[model samples]
Target chain A: MVYELYYWPGIQGRGEFVRLALEEGGAKYIDIALKPENRGGGVPAMNKFLEGPRVPHPPFAPPFLKVGKQLIGQTSNILLYLGGPLKLAPRDEAGKLWVHQLQLTVADLVVEAHDTHHPIAAGLYYKDQKAAAKRRAEDFREHRIPKFFNYFEKVLTRNRTAGPWLVGRRVTYADLSLAQVVAGIRYAFPKASTKALRKHPRLMKLHDAVFERPRIKRYAESGRRLAFNNDDLFRNYPELDG
Target chain B: MVYELYYWPGIQGRGEFVRLALEEGGAKYIDIALKPENRGGGVPAMNKFLEGPRVPHPPFAPPFLKVGKQLIGQTSNILLYLGGPLKLAPRDEAGKLWVHQLQLTVADLVVEAHDTHHPIAAGLYYKDQKAAAKRRAEDFREHRIPKFFNYFEKVLTRNRTAGPWLVGRRVTYADLSLAQVVAGIRYAFPKASTKALRKHPRLMKLHDAVFERPRIKRYAESGRRLAFNNDDLFRNYPELDG
Candidate 1:
């Protein structure tokens, strides 16, 4: 059976990380929310699984995966489940945990990116807290992004043999998620991320290399993949970009 | 062999979640950063392991558990590793992921709590970012905390048979970490959290229940259980409290 993937339809958001795994590994899955409601899709369809009586383990938010009777949420948790089947993670337990840890850190960076646009509150609109976002973006663009870049660079430096991938010698979910992060960051903060990306050649190389992957490149070119926009996480509010 | 846990000394922080698992489960471990430098433990000791050549899997930050040559970081990551041997998580893979999802949400709340005080810059002190923090805390106090409380309350309500545990009948690491979040929130925003906590009696019960566990209660009363202070993730800065 094709796994059912639930997430908001329009944006890459966190769902893209899971999407990359399925796409790159050629897993059979349906983007449940993207389909028509009559055919058991749309927000309401996703909501049923979220709070439906059938699902004992309700997801707090979307980007949850459904297979048979089992449902899993949290981007990293879903990746962990899919990693082995997809062979996108290491075989050893320690190796799996290492990849998961890196993805969790990527999740942290994603949160920071969202905060840059919505510093005062995620519930509030960008215009409502524009000033706070401006200041917050400065810290994110200057301090936070660079700190993350440096940390990842160090991780890569420590494992030069691995080259492009963040962990070990093979491409893992961590690399896929990191590639998404670089894309989002580059889209959202073109000027700032350009300079920042330049500082880490290995990271930039990984970004280019991930995009160069036949499957990933085809998926990106395939219009099935959504583009990053102002409405999503890692939005490019020109004013917020220092 | 006793596990070597490397986290910053003098604060409960994220490490406490790991420490709670060890203390409550009665696992043998050392708080590496807390030991004297003369005896081969301190910030340097922790830093050495962070970037150490011997560690095949170097963690991005502390609160990493060192077992033989493998170093696992990230509070939840460490908890996931320790949960098995400690039997603090469920036996089934699906059940384990469920508990972990709850913990990751707890981790989200922790990040939100930390951001309330340092909305502008983590590198900057609370004193330096008080204004932005004031606005951020208001949103957190009014919207964020209640949302998280309601979500957890719903989770607990769904698993009423489990009572205070949040999962099934047994007390998993999620319950332990959640109890820490409740305590830290109460300590940081006494006025707001008190009013908020009243709405989620089940969660309040879970908080009380976890604290009342024999080993947990002993750990709390023990001088080794560090007090929550301004320097930590959940600090009671009276000015920031809404």
Candidate 2:
């Protein structure tokens, strides 16, 4: 059965994490919003999910997946569900839990990154709160980026598996998500990420390894991989970047 | 074996959710941070969890639980782990996933609440970012709270069980977290939550039911349940509280 993913169409926002997993796993799925003739494209679909009748198990926000009758939401939770079936998570319970904890941490970093651009209100335009955005961006760049990178670096260096993947000997969704994060940081704050990467060799190596994976390489090379832009979470504002 | 919970000493903050679970389940555990004579008791332990490196899997933030050799972090993840063994989660995979999604959504709301005060930087003083805080709080109160509450209201109303709990018949961690969210909203935005709760009868009923539980009732009556304060996530700032 083909998985139906519902997210904003244009930019690779939070949904990109799920997109990356599907792409790397070579799983058959439809980016519902991006498909032409789908009146229930991004905005409409997101509204349907939000404003529609109360689901017995409601998802708070977008990037939810529907496979048959099962609708799964929350980026990390969705990824956790797919991890096992799509071969994106570890088999062992302990390993799976650890990977999940790492994903939750990544989700925290993503929220922080998004907030840097919209410090005042997500509903309000970025232009309206540029000054506040600058301040928040600085804190994110100086404190959060380094802190998160250092943690990921520690995990990569400390992994006893002696492999490039975050868990066990195989590639997991954590690696894919990490790659996307690294890519976003590079696009949004090139200078900061480059400097931070110098001290996180293992992390950089993992990023490079993920980039070179046969499936990941094909996904990136293909036109399917969305480029980072101002509309998405990791937006580039020179004033915000140090 | 008793569970060992490490979190900040004074504030109920994020740790209260875990405390509620332990209390409701009648589980034996040590709140290392709250104990006296252990260098301010739990605070030191919480700090050690934050700063210590000996542990293989270190938590990015506090409210982490240590069960034997396993160290679980993230409020929802901790609850997910405990929910199963402690009979807090549902039996089936679909039910478990649904509970997790609910917990994660609650986590998102929690982050939004924290951002209201620390709109600029988590490391900076709230006073320093009063202007931004005002703007953020406006958005949170005017937009976010209603949206989140409505979604949850729908969830409770749509439950097949038509019961007070979030999932099936049992009281899962999602229910506990939802109760906390309701209490936090009431504490932080009394006028708004009171108005909002009227529109969400199911949610209000669930909140009342959770509070009425014997274990939860005793826990709340006890001094262990910390009161809302400026230092915690949901602070009552009249200027920000609409």
DockQ values, each candidate: 0.64, 0.72
Write the residue-wise lDDT of candidate 1 on B1-242 in tens digits: 79999989889898899999998889889888899999999999998977677555677787889888787888888888888999999999888889988888899999999999988878888888788899899999999999899888888888857357788899999999999999999999999999998999999999999999999999889889999998999989888785
Interface RMSD, Å, model 1: 1.8
Full-model lDDT for every candidate: 0.88, 0.85
Q: Tens digit of lDDT per residue, candidate 1, span A108-177?
A: 8999988888878888888988887888899998889998998888788777574688887899999999
- The C-alpha local distance difference test score for the whole of candidate 1 amounts to 0.88
Worst 10 residues of 2 chain B by lDDT: B37-46
Model number with the top DockQ: 2
Off by more than 4 A, model 2:
A38-50, B37-41
Best by TM-score: 1
Sorted into a CAPRI-style docking class, model 2 comes out as: medium
Tell me the tens digit of each residue's lDDT in model 2 across B7-93: 877788889899889988899999987788545574666776666666578888888898888889888888888887789998888
